[model samples]
Target: MTQATAPCCDANPDPRTLRGCCIGLSVATCLLFSGATTAADSFWSTIQLHGFAAQSVIKTSDNRFFGDSPDTSFDSTEIGVNASVRLDPKVLVAGQVLARRAGDMYDGTPSLDYALTDIALIASPERILGIRLGRVKNPLGLYNETRDVPFTRPGIFLPQVIYYDKVRNIVLSSDGAAVYGSLYNDLGEFSVTLVGGWPVLDDNVQWTYLGGDFPGTLRPNGSVWTGSLWYATVTEQLRFGLSGALASLRYAPHQNDILGPGQTDIVYGIASLQYSARRFTLSAEYGLEPVRWRRYGPLLPRQKVTSEGYYLQGTYRIRSNLELMACYEEGVADSDDRDGSEFAGVTGGLVPAHAMFSKIATVGLRWDPTPNLMLRAQYQWNQGTLVLSQLENPDFPRQREYWTLLALQVAFRF
Candidate 1:
């Protein structure tokens, strides 16, 4: 049956925000009492609990970006539980909860910010249409849809080269709703979507000393809107798809907050191409952003920031249990506000020029000894360039950073 009428299954693993976890309790309750209701007659109303858990161990010679220490950091583990229930034949409800190492999450920061990521309801009355409300992915890019699960991704992490909007986990997911649908013909299926929402900000930002010892983030709240469109085709031997996305956010400065725009806007544009052959998958993307600012308080600068980036990744099936993967990416950021750039500014200086660029080469092996388990090992060499030396402090290393890691993941569905 098509997804629209297939009797809503458990929530897929995407909703991992703050309140998303509440949905999990719903699943646990149903699971504890659902055994008595199973029959073909109401089979569609069954409940399912889904989850994604992962742990990555890296032998870091230096915490390059995380200045806590320039030496070896501790091994980290991140786990999340997502429980979903098919409330009705046409509706699905889900909740998620996550636990990451104190020094990790969204960024290399130390935060026990164990809060809900997303809590929402989804309905797909037809294969051509789907709607979700509550905390949902803003639907801005290809990666955002699949980012919550590492095993479903092409890389250990979505290339930071182009995914740096993650600096402050900017506009990751929002408290809102979205509608998506597709038009199908004998030839292909074309899809479209429109999504908008607001983000709940937590006190997790680190502010630089502002003379009198007051430090905090500006624009405590930012308005956000994210949307996208795509088309897909599947032939006997070849499958292809085309997609694009947009993200826009506005932040108004706060009183006494030094590192925020008087009023700021962020926009992202992206296009991707994908092709699959007998045992190979190839994907490439190009993205651009034009950041604009206005009404800066005297504490800030007046300026416009624009940047662009691209990445290409390919996976080759070497054996039934192995694959070869590699990708190359680079981005250029230019800002009118020198010192405070990236999330809240202050990472660099105010000059309209290439702010920074990152280059990385990774080769890895994937072994799926069991259907629900995997073992992966990879070696990566990362190099970054910053227009100023100060920008190269921890993250943008003036020199090359090298690391080799072995990671193991095991998961199951009940």
Candidate 2:
């Protein structure tokens, strides 16, 4: 007997409506702060504002990324503003608003990135406990929380294998609460965070998983939970982290749609390590994501697939203003079917085997022209199309197994 496919969203709200809502929220927040007294002794003195803007140019030998990169596209831009205020010694509130455009993946829409209130339950020098309520950034791999900030990243682009942009929204942040704690001792310094909440689902997520803009819509149907543990030595030169999450979603089909309702469960874990010296830094991360699907319709089968990926990266500061970096990243859709031949065969060769995995070697240079300005240039040699966004490369048959990409970006922060 055949089963129905997963249920997904049939339609979404207008982009302008979403943008307007975010803008209104930001305006209200600003108004709230404006009502505070300007006196030096007032709580306004403890407020801080920060933001950044970046633009990138990308070119590709084959396949499109971030735009029509067949030639060169300047279709990538990121801008964000954030604020934080300390209500007291133990209470703080922080939030950020962002607008981004990246070809077909994102269309320069304003959104609420993160807004949370943090309370220190136990405050001490060596040990502290805290809880955060609101939309919080997910504590996953090393670079996930700060992925949008160019200054905090080693290169223009992070390793795509583990931090794939295709499914970024699913892991970026969540609307939930978290409890965190830290302990310091002679043995080591350790920190732990546990969070449970609902994930943000968007059209991009649906496109990434369903292969295109399906008639049905996909949304988070159940709760998602994540936890991370980190350790660092007394010297703070070496650090390690372990993170994991369980995410579930349901797809509801539109009336008259050919697809049936379905559900997906994803469990993933990541291990990360980093070593830093005065002018050199080395880091690596490995991740395993196992996905299970049920009642996915006749075209798709009910199956369990485990994806694995890893990356090794190093950065060296040649001078106070110049830095060089290199990295090797690899990802496989299924460890048991590394080549994807079986998948292609099962799908009647409609999907290429290269779609199952990706390997990338990259090198880049970063120049800090000033304290708040940065310029970067990078080159990548990629094998396979596993990590590329389907929205950008709609025609899979036109994609090449081997391709090269060059990117240049300018960023400013204040």
Candidate 3:
């Protein structure tokens, strides 16, 4: 997905830090190339800068309410910046920043929270390998990297079922590196990459409630390594692609609430397929994570959480500037317990841990009134299962859960 096809953005059009960084690099790269600036550096002898902004309004409804009301509201605004400099004809560098509101994401916080979003470099495609680093976004699935941009995506909201981790875990980056290349083969053009690294940002940690004492804190502490292989080719008016990965996440011992000193073994796999033509494009993906969470705490439960998810979607370009899109997703998680009840409803009444499921369906339209502007509107239906504590529950502690939401966003690119 590309940001150009999404919706809603205005005000705070760019972040000052990223702007300064890229501009600084442009000047440095120019000085390194020659003693001074060159004519080739410009769109006419300089740097090119541009960006987009967006705002979203979300409404929610719960079928069965345990607390609060049956309806709620949230708003999110985002600012994106893209700057590029031509060090020379054969060498160039580029950077991007994405800052969005805290809105519905962080319940305890207000006033949009921001961070260093994405940083990458483009090189000659013919090289044996291309590399990129620095708080790099993880491209685990087909649309994870480009879904935020309207021009690259069919709809405003990507399948939340798949992007759930990315939305909440903003530290979705690798502090390592990746080497990639394209090879010509009989099957098609093969894109191969070998990547590995650790979490780039370690400023945030998640917490879970037990009672007066806070335990069961899920800390993002670890190092990950993975490799990928993909293939895509063009035939007539149609194009198709497929990708796969084998990765490992090892968490070193760290002390916390529920988890005193622990680690989690993660083996995740991903696959995707896509086909396209002038009128429409279709794509789908499936992902699985086999996890074994271990801890050395009397209150923490030794468990293995298996997570799996998939989605199917399509977009049809009705005309030169208008398009319609839709998608459906199903996600599931199964946790296995060794004891009778690791957690129960009451005090000392071993709590029973069970399996959980989630599903979502979304449909929307994107209006490209002009090449640089997009308008989007979408409706989503979601449902999930939850467990509440006996008395002063565990967190929100509701046995079962369900929700209906209406989301609208507008996106633009320059």
Candidate 4:
């Protein structure tokens, strides 16, 4: 997906304004660096700096994955720099700045990904409790928190069924607070996290929900709430989690806009499980997302959709530095309208039926010649376009129901 400019939503910052904010971030980073060096030796010792960079090449036989991948595009890149400072034994501050370029999906713009203060109110050998304030990562299924990090993710690309790239920005992080606690016992470990915050309302989010050509702007109107509960065995070989979130937003039309005021409510839940051994790992996740839209003028009718998705993945370690993985993923835009006939009928057959569902099979390999350098290659067979980003696949009529994609990536971290 490539990032393109569009009319700003009511709560969206202007592109120019965001550029200026990036400049401010640059200055702040410099100051933080200077303070780390000039403050006290102890203070400097408490600060840590880390970063990662990655580039990928993608090619698709029928549809583009990132940019016009039909010709082998180098339109995927990710770079991030983060710093953390320990204010006290139980308090810490951390922030990350990221620049990501995904053909038509995201532009290589520097942005503050997360800046949060973590305070551990209770800490013990067997139990821990903490709160995170500010821009915090939303703990979705299993891999969301570290999804952006190549080193942390199980594969180069996560399963689109549960982690759809089209709405990544909306679910990635939130501006708010979270309370988390964990307990360790002889039998197993249990943890819980609850968060309430305002979701990031960006152009991509609007473009995903409303057609990019829509005249009105979509913005967040209310807070979002999310919670997760996780359990793992004492050896940490088996783990499972349940997570859910509720998000609300509204659309405000311009004076000349053809669309009327509209509101959207989304509720989703995910169940995840993973089993890890010395050389093999098996994982599976299932999700249900119900979305409601109301009052989009007379042009767009009210809608209620319950989408369902799931994935099963397995990985085998061939060597200390080599791993192989395969996954089967499926997603349906509406459980009741699996073929999209109802949606197409409602839209006067303007939308393709294939757009309502997607099934993908993927196989990939990862090699780490060095601890800080990683290489990955993957192939995907896709049967639908439900997870494709509208910004990337603007010409919906031209999209193919079946497509093949090949991707290769190199990543480095320090």
The segments of candidate 2 whose C-alpha lies over 4 angstroms from its true place after superposition are 1-11, 14-42
Error of 4 at 174 (Å): 1.2
RMSD (CA, Å), each prediction? 9.9, 4.1, 8.3, 4.3
lDDT of 2 by residue, 13-104 (tens): 53333443343345435544653444336567889999999999999999888899988989898999999877666767788888888877
> In candidate 1, residue 42 scores what lDDT?
58
List where candidate 1 sits over 4 angstroms from the true fold.
1-45, 60-70, 102-127, 165-168, 202-216, 220-222, 235-261, 335-355, 385-414
Model 1, 58-153: lDDT tens per residue? 543333332222343333444556655554444455555545542332332322112222222342333456666655655555676546466777
Give per-residue CA lDDT, model 4, range 161-229, as digits (tens): 899877786678777789999999997899999988777667677776665545666777788888999
Cand. 1 TM to true fold? 0.71
Give candidate 4 misplaced runs (Cα > 4 Å).
Answer: 1-41
Put the candidates in TM-score order, highest first: 2, 4, 3, 1
TM-score of each: 0.71, 0.91, 0.71, 0.90
Error of 4 at 366 (Å): 0.2
Worst 10 residues of 4 by lDDT: 1-10
lDDT of 3 by residue, 1-414 (tens): 000101222222223234344434554454446733554435335467777776666665743212232343344566667665555553334555666543423222221121222222343433344664333445556665554455676666666555552223322444455566765545556666655555422111221111222223323445565556666663423333333333332233334444356544555667777777788888787767566656635643555565677888888889978888888887665433212133333224322332145577788887888888888887766665221111212333343355666767777778
Between candidates 1 and 2, name the one with more favorable lDDT.
2
